[model samples]
Target: MSNEEKQAPQDQVEDVIESEVAQEDAALVDELTQANFRIEELEQALAEAEAKAAEEKDAALRAVAEMENIRRRAAIDVEKSRKFALEKFANELLPVIDNMERALLGTVEDEAAKAVIEGVELTLKTLMTAVAKFGITPVDPMGEAFNPEHHQAIGMQPSTEYPANTVMLVMQKGYLLNDRLLRPAMVMVSQG
Candidate 1:
């Protein structure tokens, strides 16, 4: 009950309070460290997720570009198919035109066959008009310079009236469908 005894008990209480405060500080520091580690793990996970999303986005864009290219190519193919669709049919009708032309040439001088000739001429004119509407055009290369791409040389002849390598005569006229050659013109080329 003296002053020393009283001072000793007070010191003991102060030590106990200091010890509790130190333990609490240590626990708080440990919790803070664990929280910092967790935050770092979460940030790394977020970065990985962002990288993966970027990769997927790039792949999706590439796929879309490829699809667009394929669509464009398909459209071009369809347009080409539409343009050349009548090539085969026009080819088959060429011989009929040639035969009609031959018949007309033969019957021109006959006076008695005048009515028949007129009918045939009218028919041929109608046929020509019909074919022309469908982009079927004749390649009559008479007097033009010989183009091997459009005219096939059946034979060559010497000519003073035409320049060298000119198309002097067409044996069989060619036909075109949509500016594309259905058949080459059979021609006689002039020689130098």
Candidate 2:
């Protein structure tokens, strides 16, 4: 109950309170460090996600561009097909034109035959004009140099009127449709 006894009790109480406050400060520091580490981890994860999203977006754009190019190429091919669609029909009609020409070249001894020949001549000319307008052109190789691409040599004959390897006679005329060979001219070439 003296001064020293009273001072001892007061000092004990202050030391207990200081220890508790120090423990609380240590716990708060630990929590703050943990929070900072978590923030860094979240920042790294966000950066990775953003980079992945950018890569996916770029891939999608490239795919769209490639598809557009393919569509454009397909449209061009379709247009070219449409332009050449009449090639087969024109080729089939070439024989009919040849027959008409042969009929017109026949001798007309009687007046009735002459009139019929004249009518055939007119028809052949009209058909030729019609075919020409549709990009159909005749390949008459007679007296021209033989070309393997445009002329098919059926026979070889000795000829003094023209040079060797020249087209002496075109057995059947060929045809072209829009600069493309529909058929090669069947011809007899002069032997070298």
Candidate 3:
């Protein structure tokens, strides 16, 4: 009931209020710290996701480039196949052409035989034209420099008109299918 007694009780109440406020401030600081840590963790996870996405993008681009290269190569292969489709057939017909050439080289003095020869000559010309249309070309090395790639020398002989190592006579004409040699020309070379 006195003044001192009243003052003591009021001080005790103030101290209790200060203690509660301090406890609340400490809890708020702890919550803020936890939130900040969670934000940092989220940022790290986002960075990792971005890196993975970049790697996947690079891999996809590389795969697309590889596919394009394969497509280009396949297109080239198909074009080559289209150009050389009749290679085997042309190669098989070479022996028939050689025999026809040999038959044409023989002379016929009789009138009836001359007509037959003319017919055979015309047939050979027609066959040659057909083969040429399919990119089959003749390799006639007669009177030119002999090359091992296109010409096969059966024998060498001394020649007066040609230089040494030159093709003197073509024994059997070879054929080429589009720049590639189907058969080598059999030839006689001039001796060095």
Cα RMSD of all models vs. native, in order, equals 3.4, 4.7, 3.5
Better of 1 and 2 by TM-score: 1
- In order, the Cα lDDT scores of the candidates are 0.93, 0.92, 0.93
Per-residue C-alpha lDDT of model 2 across residues 9-113, encoded as one tens digit per residue: 898898888889999999999999999999999999999999999999999999999999999999998987987999889978988998997887668699988
Query: Model 1 off-target regions past 4 Å?
Result: 1-36
Find the candidate with the highest TM-score and give its number: 3
Residue-level lDDT for 39 in candidate 2: 95
TM-scores, all candidates, are: 0.76, 0.70, 0.78
Question: Residue 101's C-alpha lDDT in candidate 2?
Answer: 79
- Indicate the worst ten consecutive residues by lDDT in candidate 1: 103-112
True-structure lDDT of candidate 2: 0.92
**Per-residue lDDT of 1-192 in model 3, one digit per residue for the tens?**
999899898988988888899999999999999999999999999999999999999999999999999999999999999988888898789999999899999888999999999999999999999999888999998889989999999999997888999999988998999988999999999987
